[model samples]
Target chain A: MAHVISMLPVRNEAARWLRATLEQLSILTDRIVVFDDASADDTADFCKSYPKVRYYRGDIPWFEQNEAELRRHLWELATYENPEWILALDADELFEERATLELPWLLNQEDYDAVAFRIFDFWKGTEQVRIDGAWNPWNRFSPLLVRYDSTLSPDWMAQPIHCGRFPLSYRDRVTFYSHLRVQHFGWARGDEHLKKYLFYRERDLAVYGAVQSHTESVLSSSITLEPWIPMPSPGWFSEKEHR
Target chain B: MKKRIAILTSNHFEPSGARQVYGGAERYGVELTKLLLDMDCDVEWWQVGDNWNKEIIPGVPIRGVPETETPYQTMPHLNQVFFEQAVDADGAIYFVMYLAYPTVFPNSISISHGIYWDHPGMDKFLPSALDRQEWHRRLQLAIGGVRSVVSVDTATINWVRATWPILAQKFSYVPNFVDLNSFYPQNKESRSPHPRLRVVFPRRATTVRGINEAGKTALWLTESHTDLEFHFVGRAHDDNMERTLTTWASSHDRIFYYWLPPHLMAELYRFSDIVWIPTKSSEGTSLSCLEAMASGCAVITTAVGGLCDLIQDGYSGLLIEPTARALADATKRLASDPQLRERLGTHAREVAETFSLDRWHSRWSEVITRVF
Candidate 1:
């Protein structure tokens, strides 16, 4: 059987959805690299309890203070497993069940060096219910899975706010878009969402030299989360459900 | 007294040249400048470009930011200029939120071109979240000083009001115009009399303009019909799209590509039996529909934003949803009927003439005078 590893660089993700998510991930990948960035919460102790998970903590604060550094360190630690492929996901992100099966086959294929998937960013409290201009006016294609090359990785920067840039060279030609989707639940908690936006506003001013929006301005226009069940597009997700 | 106003843009607005999809707001600046000049108003131009017309409205001044090798230098210069001119001009008009100017001018107005990176659904289309935030923040700076927020279409007006409640009552509608004299009809008989139908796409070769959709239609038609010819007039937005299109065009003999200046476009329309404008919702009224109609070609478009206001299916032009396969079906329908194409082209020209530069000036002249 091909070896697959899951790499997660986390800061303050505690008792939310981490436990249940890990249980699901363990079914597909044997080893899980959980890089803890000196969290004030009991995230490190909780993650250490999992059998298939390898939790590591940095000495100084890095996740909130310096995201790029945390990601670089996570990438470095994921390399030690020498796995066939790495599924790098954020603490708040989860794979659609179909992606769990489709990923193994996609990582086995030689046509692509990296794999991207449609990201169903749940607005407020709902899932992929509203796609076409119904919820947040945004839907995205993001790189969630990468073929493991022991020698190569994304170059890290000190103050990169948005996930550090991926290489454009191989991304243009060799990237394959998978039928699976990623369910993002970051905007579910109000405190978490507000903190992230405020941190981003300050960081943007430091890096870009201009930012005029207040946190309340975004909140005023934000979509109210609906209690709708996830209605993912009919693809591999539906095919698996029929079985 | 004539109202003195200034407009800011990122793309250099050439006074005269080959016309491309500069859209409603960009062209509105020049037209308003002309109309203001006719009303004896002083209109100046400020933007970052190589060619800055020193005398935009005879005595009115103009300035372009000297090409900064890096964006770092450009923003500082813009901030300096904005600070200096914030209280000076009678009014100002910013094309979009991404233009990075003051949000509010007591007498000034801002125009909404379409969705920007910061807009809720634009994560995939734009560069990054940081870029979107920067644009969002910059847009907030001038919200207080501007008198009204203007958009080219009603849908966008509704969208802006709903999205930015701060600018709720400020949003207004101003449809884009097509110069009838410049893009006047060619003798329909002068076109190739062969049974083959010639289709023209007057758009910048970008995904936003539905190039992939156009490609789908072109590829299918090339395989299915020997009686259809496709002509792509505008250049690609990026090198990747350019290379992809160049390779694609090379494979098909039925496809003809032209990336000439806008000055050559008036005559260029004479060769088309139909012009396809299947673009995304990011546009106000498609200038392509009006221009194609004025050039005496039937327009087949999608009801994205402003195009809905312009096209009356079976009358002025054909309308469909924004999809590649749908566009292919529409093209096939137009190809099969020449008289319908002729009738639509004629009525489309009439529609284009109604929304001429003259009508735009007369309609906005009072509003411009009242605002300033």
Candidate 2:
């Protein structure tokens, strides 16, 4: 059997999409390690209650922590589980079927060191993925599903404040499995929607200061589906993949 | 009872490395005239530069007028000559290629291929700079007298209409379509194996085509994808372009080819996995891009001219700014993903089917009828 484990680093994700996101990953992998960054809510206690999830506490608060260092440490800590491959995840992300992506068969393949999945940034609800403006990663983003080879960890961190440090050395070895879609629910719900936007803006202001040039716009209610083109189906919900 | 039509061009249209050929406008003029003749419409083709007069087609005679002897002036007397020639023609239309007009007949349509002001610094080209001031006056002259204005893309028509609101009511959108039969996709299962993922650019060796930007993109893409190959297929316009590209090709092992005949051009498009057109301006429905789509190559182009009409960014194709960095980044995105390429190619082919030669003939016939 191919040994597969998942890694997640999150904070204050109590009422966010954490529970549903974990439930989805549970069916795909045997183990999960979530590093809780000092959540004020019962997030730490709630994650530990899951059958496959193992909760660990981060030293710093979520906002105070440097995302790159946190991501690198979490990635390194997960390798201690000694799994053949790791399914790296954010609390807000949900993996979807790639028509015929057999994870077991994929893990057994000797060719690739990492796999990059397409990310659909869901806004307002599960049905719509944000494709407007520069704030989003547009239509595609590659979060790593890396093999636990000692030399294979990414040297480069996710820039301008996202998660995961990507390695320049793994460029050729990385296979773009776009069918393995990830539905990002970071911007869709309650006050968490506006909070996430302000969180990034706050981070930007703290670093770049007053000259940040509008910090990119949030997905407004006015934004709707691209009526002319068919969008890739969000992985969170079992919506029919639009052709 | 076919309507008589006269088409005008400022340059001759032959393939690169032939007797003489220029840029996109020259090629487009040739293709349009040929297609019109194939429809059995009465056609008269006139060109400036050479005085040689001959009939390339049975009924259609190509009249070439010599450029008047003057420094930095090409066909200064064309305005008078074209007016006199059109007396015999039922209707005359001058193809407005560079926002520069050699001639504009009264009550005739002015079909713009490019807008000068839209692409800033384009007036600095040595040939165009000589008569740059003349273009503004001649354009204003054409706007008043011309029956209507036609543009190949909605963006260009909108720009023209916005710039000169006086011509707003007289503007129409008539895009040039592709030869779907000649350039088409074969079944993926039956194709021959390619050793490398081919990236082809069907752009001429000219500054406007963005060859230099394409060179930078190829260099940047090579670091990630060692098997990536870039093939440029078009005649070099000058010795300078040839020398520059030749030097770039020498530095890289993957850079290949100079140009291909139309038959071989079809094969190249079919063979390519990705197509890149670096042109920022002077594209009135880029035929090469349309042909690539028909041949099933996923295209990425600078978001300029008629490209915005064909591509929907990440959908059918990618539209980015005409910069080396932008081209390199977009190329890397498309080069890494096979599924994205396949999806985009499938959608692109569907788009090409909509603007097939039959549809082009329909649109062309209407323009001729309405203009006359």
Candidate 3:
């Protein structure tokens, strides 16, 4: 028997949405671990009511700091819980009926480390969702299930709004699974919340760029550029090495 | 017998509420004209910058008149040429708020967009350096001889009706409406992906119209409530405001800002838990506030201008007198109480359904049919 664990990274969320997420967690997953990146509201305390949920507290200095730390901690927690499969998620994302049942089966498949599920975005309200009824073109990917033994872990590139990486990092080592659906709740009228996320994103990019350049300059001066007196061009270096 | 209605505006699209677009009167002109067209009457649109006699709809004609050589001084004269051209028609619905042109015809109906009054600077919010005596004089001259008058709301009509009480008596409140079919609430999942308290503030960076206490309240809320995310939409008016906000946002990870398209803005209302727009002064009925309410967002706003008409305290949404403290307190109230947010959001959406496009078009059709 394979152990399954779900993880959600959340900041501040609407109450109804939070309640929905909790409901989904109770039914589908064995253990739900949520990393509260020092949320400003009762999100932390609220998650505490559920016994199956494990909440980790972390201080977020900036947007990037929060995302990076959350991913790292989620990996650590998932690894420690030692679930055979880790279903990574955000507070608003949920598994569709098909994916909820098929997720375990897909993860257990031989040589599969991570699985990407198709995310149906209910762009319109409850009425539209009912009318359009499952086949809308707007659905994308939701990466809630990942094998712990896989090489995939948290990295800097997996930071912003969409932290999932594609092209299935290991084409040869891992097998691809499809037809599974994960429902994404990102597009709801909560775009006002998105503005706040963008603000931090802009700042995060600026700081990340500045730090990257600063590090490159420091590294080049001490190691790469300083050692080469004349600092020969590419052609010269290639010629010398070949000769 | 179809009436040919002429609407004077700068653009066909009025995306946001308040004075951002064709100003209040110009938008009112557009709304009135659209209403007439919906009633199956022949309508024509006249914009300042558009080409003359462009076809907007088949029988419904639209025209644009470019400003004259000396833009500031010659616009009124150019508008006069257009006005003269329009005089031969059966009747004209003119949004002549500024001193663009004098509608000499007895049949012209002037809708008041704004007033220059004694100090034009007060209305324009210009620096003390520029002399606005001419602006004020020209505005007074424009209103001096109009036969029929219209205003967007009671406050604006009241301001004008003090001078022309007869016209004020003739004043009718024709509110703006959003097409619910085009702009409705998003599904529950997209609106609130996680259970984080979503606080949305959709105001431009203008000091007069924007959430003045956003920066302070955001910082305070971010520090106190980590689970709450604050979203500030619309563009900043200047470099100073942008820089100030950027600096303020540097302190917290939760504070997020985004520049979005109108469709995306509609989507935001779905996701946001609470939509906050606290304006100090100069507000007509806010399309943004109405849109948010329609899209199922619990709203907190100041009782300014037409917002009073839309936001009913303890029912649809919360209305507080404009202040940082009031804004913060209202936000805190919604943030702490999930039940209140859900209840208010549910009611707000129901109330928004009443102001649909069909209702707006019907009301406007009456004004147009009257011209016949």
User: Which one wins on lDDT?
Assistant: 2
DockQ score, prediction 3: 0.01
Judging by TM-score, tell me the better candidate of 2 and 3: 2
- For residues A1-243, write the lDDT of model 1, one tens digit per residue: 468888887776787768756876787687999988778898887788788999898878875566777777787788788877777778877776644544554454443466666555565564333343333312334676666765553566546655542322223323444435567776666566677677767877876776545433445554444233332221322333333
Please give, as one word, the docking class of candidate 1: incorrect
Off by over 4 Å in 3: A1-243, B1-4, B10-75, B85-90, B99-101, B112-148, B183-192, B236-252
Sorted by lDDT (best first), the order is: 2, 1, 3
lDDT tens digits, residues A1-243, model 3? 368888777677536477778777766678988777667888887898888888886776333444554566566776678777777766876665433433444444432355555454443232122112233322322444655654553344444423442223322122232433455555444344456445545654665643333222221323211010111111211222232
True contacts kept of 3: 0.00
Error of 1 at A180 (Å): 46
- What TM value does the first chain of each candidate achieve? 0.80, 0.77, 0.65
Instruction: Please give the CA lDDT of all the candidate structures.
Output: 0.64, 0.66, 0.57
lDDT of 1 by residue, B99-127 (tens): 44433455666666644332335554335
TM-score of each: 0.51, 0.55, 0.50
Q: Per-residue lDDT of B13-94 in model 2, one digit per residue for the tens?
A: 3312113453456556656777666666688777664566544333356677655442232344654566676577777777
